[model samples]
Target: MIIRTQVSFSVTGTHFTPSKVPAPFSDSHDPGVIGTVGRFRGAPVPYGSAGFEAPEKEMAKIAWIYERVSPYKSAMRDAGAEHCTLSVTYTYDSQCALSFSQEELKMIVDLDCYFHVDCQTAT
Candidate 1:
């Protein structure tokens, strides 16, 4: 079963500040990330994370998450992001699968973004 959901986006570039991305939950800047595992590859450049960890109960549903993020498209586009990724993270205690609707997929396409889903199963 799902225990937590984080719907977020990230942008990276040498020319833009990440804090400018419109994220209400939280936002941060990292010089880089070091990775030792498969999914956590390291990035050695300016990185900004759009606020996630949506507190609103409705955000757990992907549609709502997309809706919440929709308004920030312009900010993301202008965030000086040489590249951008739109992602949804699920923290769960069991095995499961996720599905998406056309509307959800459209958001990614609309933004011309790379989409990734991170499923972390609790140990």
Candidate 2:
């Protein structure tokens, strides 16, 4: 069972700084060679990211952030970013199944962003 889930969106590449990626990002940092929790590294520039998380709600977390970024796809690409992504991570206590509905996948396709999902057993 999934104990918690988080969904985040990011524009990252080796060319542009976070500042160049435009506004509305909740997290930003310079890239590093080694990655740490919540900090994406090794791009040599910066990562601009934003996330949406809610406690105890059943609504899909990805929906909460979709509207905010959907309109900026082109602008973000114009910022010299080589990639835009929607990353979902699930923390589970028992079984963790990696699956997605067609609608869920369509959202990612519409945004032209990579979809990355990770599952971890709760310790």
lDDT of 2: 0.66
Off by over 4 Å in 1: 18-25, 28-53, 60-79
Question: What local lDDT does model 1 show for residue 46?
Answer: 43
lDDT tens digits, residues 2-73, model 1?
777777655566565556665553555634545444555664444444444445466535565556566776
Backbone collisions counted per model = 0, 1
Among all windows of ten consecutive residues in candidate 1, which has the lowest summed lDDT? 45-54
**lDDT of candidate 2 over 1-123, digit per residue (tens):** 988887877777665455555556676654433455543443333443333333236466665567667766666667656777778888999998767778777777887877888999999
TM-score of 1: 0.60
Instruction: lDDT for model 1, please.
Output: 0.62
Candidate 1 backbone clash number: 0
Instruction: Enumerate residue pairs that collide in model 2.
Output: 32-42
Best by TM-score: 2
